[model samples]
Target chain A: MKFMSNKTLKMSKVLLSAVLSVGIIASLSGCGSNESAKNSATPPADSAGSNLIVSQTNPIVIDKEAKTVKVYTEVNGKYFVEPTRHGVVFKDGSNGSKSVLKAWGNQNDFYNGLVDIGAKPGNNLKLDSVGVAVEGDPLDVSITWAGAGKEIPFGDGILDSTKKGFDFRFGGNQENAKAKNTGCILCLDSCPVGITSNAAHPTKDFDNKIAEFKGNQEVLPADGTPVVVTFKLK
Target chain B: MNTKQRKWLNVLGSGLLGFNFGFVAALLLAQWTWLELRVNTGLAILVGVGIGLGIGLLRTIKRPLAVESISLLAMLISLLGIGDAQISSLKILTGYTIREGLLMPDISLQVANLIFSLLTLGSILSAIVLKRKISG
Candidate 1:
């Protein structure tokens, strides 16, 4: 390194600083203005006022080329939830699914809980935030959280990504498929019927229709698309 | 460079590499998804890559693969900072950040921008510290 001239070091400093400063400024500056009240500080929590169920969709497709998952979900409230497609979409690059899930808690347990409890990851999942609500019986969602915010049905550990994620699968008639490695604590142990496990097993719980379709392809009755889905909440 | 010096240098260099690509991916997520990211995705990525290339230059000048551990560690650290940076600013901008991804699909719009912005910063900081030895 001594062979390198001092001029070279100085140039490196200037260049590194220039690039670093610019990158930092771009990201921090582009947030528009936090001071503006226009910021939707609070995400719409309940869908009662809309007289419809709010739906949030996660569309996940396996990208065999990348040996990784390329996932996209509807950020704004949406509808027509599809079960086969949802689950954490694993993006190959930044906004990587791993850390992002930490903001919520643990994607595995949370996602698994949702699926096992009838919440599908693909475009078939719905919450009361906005969009179309399921017209059937009301959804019984057990919720939890790691930080402060509006309480979500079956929402907990929404901000934690350090732990192992939970597994989402269907219950084949042969045996209940247990998607292991749950990241969230078991919030609910008892239900009206004995169909639920003290450990919040989605496969054992009969309440979750999404969990019933694990490992097997099922045809969707609503869209006639031969897809699987869960009941969306409004 | 000596074995010890080379090892540390690589640590700093590797982070820049991971951070560069990570920054780019983060920006796209912000743009495509309505989720507001903290930093400008485009600029952040450029910065990350520039710093990474700079680190790479330093490595090749002295040694190659000497900083392998550092690179992997830095990459992981870079990912961690992304969330940190976003949450810090988000708490200030909105009363809350992402507790649940209710707004957008996977992440909340509120915290999305903030998280990636912080990630860019983390990479920049890593680059600066790592390059200091080489530059000086």
Candidate 2:
């Protein structure tokens, strides 16, 4: 009886150890995956019976007549851990802690979609300290949630908790110092796309130092809830 | 060194192991369900801590300190690994944008790796020291 119990205890401990080892190894092996591969494989969700040009591999619908572009997105990030600072952006472009919605669509596609609707892109944003000039098209962004059953304006879904806010402008992403554009679409910080209200908002790769914006949990749906984001030329 | 101290150590380690596992499980579950199940950060944390504390207070196992610490460490590493994998997969599928002329670096992964590294080191050192003390 004593030998049986000891053997069982030893076996259980070994099993626990194995579980721990395998779980960690599996997690670490996930680091090398590339999103670009998956992006090319999956087709965009269909938008039939609508006057919208939805692409084959991208998650956007462009309406030339309506002069608007819509991108499928989801409620992302949170108010507690990382304040929601971005209105809308490519999933990889914005910091997870600060972004509100990580869009499924490509940033370059969204920019082109806006252009298809006749929104001219121009260089109006000037970051004096960084000596970087930014080009942006004024955009009227809004969210339509399936859960809420209503369209919420940009200001309604996102809030400047400090009460200091600005209008969002589509700052089409710029090429890096290496002359490669990574398709960064829109940002709260004054990047290629930025808040027109804060001309002084510094450009950053991920972490935005001026993080005053956050999602209005009461108005916004739960995280990961599917939604449509509309961008109209202002 | 005494029986009471050893007993409490086992409880603490068990509780920590439970909390770590619970927290990681909650994160994975939230991702798997896409949060439609309403698994938020608060709920995950609350459930984890509650379960951990419960196991700590209620469990009667009197494991050696070295065994307890090593087990806790192993669980932490595994949980951290799974968290890393989930974050990476999410990034690969959804987060593939460029910033400053390059792919956006995995900041969360880097931070998580650093935290787990420190924890693993601490666990190793404690296990060795505790084993030596018990033997001596």
Candidate 3:
């Protein structure tokens, strides 16, 4: 390195910095400010008499005819909160880093959407500081992804996560709750609309830090791809 | 070159190098998920110090204080850049609301960014303090 003059070193450093800056700027360009609030989402004008229950501001549609609740979502990436685990999280929630799908809708609205389709709200799981499922009844619900030609159960897209699909419970309304967002739309751990475990069998309890549950990369699309998630009663 | 000219050159060069190195590290921390999630805080700090040491070892130094001062300034700028990039990356991936995301970041991301920025400063400081042995 001493053989090279100071001028050469400066030039090289400049080139390297420029290269890195461009790459990061490109990635940054892909992202836009979150304006979901400013532009309220409205349902299609054609569906006046149809059995479609749509949110005025959120991207949730309750289909009473199909006996299902549909939510708009995008792939968060194969590696979210954990190495292998890929859970579903609310778009407005803080746990997007740990979830595979980012659902763009209100959690409360999702809950009501389920109710509209005759799905009963089950007891929500409560966890200790260590994140163990101490209490809560599992709701009778089934989650699926039909973005592909055929309908695929949520368990199929996941790898080594669970045996009994996804055991979910309606984590009741949190209208006045002081948490980041009221009502849990869908989570891996204990919440009103969360699943039993993000991991299949943890050494101790259901912790989000564990990298046990992985998304099957072959089955799922790449990150940032938009898709629909459906919820139905068992 | 005169002594004064040499000193100024050394200071400016070190500061620029430090800023670029820190920016590169931030980009890596933002893009790579494994590094961000798996690497612990202590290890991250060590890595930062190591980068600083490497920068110091590369240069021929006479006046260390001037270089150190500039390096510190560079560290601050790098810290801001890293924080903004990390937040923007999270917002894009998660679609978080402006209130909860840009303004109020997740505790986990905050911890991660803090560690990364610390590493940037460590590298800059180490580089300035590290002396290249004069080869006869």
Candidate 4:
């Protein structure tokens, strides 16, 4: 009986040690296996339907004293203020006006009006500054674009002289000029400029000539700035 | 061997077996459909109870009190092992901290706790009431 009991005690110790060793090995092995699985399973950053615009440059500058919003883009080795689409809506508490400026081509095409300097279109139409001369401190301001979608919220509407306007670049390096243009439709509702107004307001209407153009809409270009929208509250 | 030493050996063997079973069950639950991994309270409780009942039936203890105690201990040990495995799997698979994974509104930890408690109670009761087979 004594010999049998001694053997039993030895067996118990062996079993306990075996169980502990297996548990330790299992726990440590899990971390390494999990790491490898995670690396292999992650998906690409820009798989279809992922609306990621990769722009590294700041493009919009707001001049409060000058009451002007300036938008700039790199075109043909030069910085130009010409955007494929630009619009500004100005309201003072009660009423407002919405003005839309668009270049010729499908709304989704990014390179519609791009031309050389001293080109036939002239500088007046190519300039990036949209002037809104309104009286009584035009308390509310909303800006929109045709080729870009809403990527960030435009914080409170109040703009100070020191405040710089919002800047965004579309379609990073792969400048597919034919990328679909999903327009920003909530710019006014997201603006923090004026007191919350519930009254129905006028919407900016696109130019019939440009809107009617039945051209092949190409993807945005892969290099340089394709689409940029900047809002400067003055 | 003495009764105390034999009882302790039985407990240790049963507890370790229960832990291993629980860990594998948790891993299987984690690798199930994505939604199951996110909210596997029902599965965890079921696994805990099953392990406890299985371990209890395999032990030689016949007294109701001893059976209940062993089963309860095994259940607690297994549940703890399962919880650890679940947290590790969530971190490895989803890159989410255990807190982040469990804090989602849809995957309530409170619900899991309730299920675990109720199942553990049922398992303890079953162990005490179930008859053990007699071997000549």
How would you encode candidate 3's per-residue C-alpha lDDT over A1-234 as one tens digit per residue?
Answer: 555545543543454354345434533443333223112322232132455443324467766776666666665542432333335666565444446666777566666677777765434333323443323333433333323554466666666544434555444434422244522365554443343232223223333444345555567654445556666554
At residue A137, candidate 1 shows an lDDT of 19
Instruction: By TM-score, rank the candidates, best first.
Output: 3, 2, 1, 4
Please compute DockQ, using alpha carbons, for every candidate against the native two-chain complex.
0.10, 0.04, 0.07, 0.02
Instruction: Please give the lDDT score at residue A124 for candidate 2.
Output: 52
Across residues A1-234, which tens digit of lDDT does each residue of candidate 4 receive?
979855644554454344344434543444444233223321112212324321323233333343333233211100011111122221110111111211111221221211111112111111122231111112223322223343223222212122333222111111221122222111221111211111112111111111111101122211122223332222
TM-scores, all candidates, are 0.29, 0.48, 0.49, 0.22
Model 2 Cα RMSD, Å?
14.1
Ranking by DockQ: 1, 3, 2, 4
Best by TM-score: 3
- Residue-level lDDT of model 3, residues B9-56, one tens digit each, is 454445444444444344335435444323321233234434644654
Best lDDT goes to which candidate? 2
| Cα shift from native, residue A61, model 3 (Å) | 1.1
Q: Give the Cα-based TM-score of candidate 3 against the true structure.
A: 0.49
Best prediction by DockQ: 1
The lDDT values for all models are 0.31, 0.48, 0.44, 0.28
CAPRI accuracy category, model 4? incorrect
Q: What is the lDDT of residue A41 in candidate 1?
A: 29
Clash count for candidate 3 is 11
Candidate 2: Cα lDDT at A163: 57
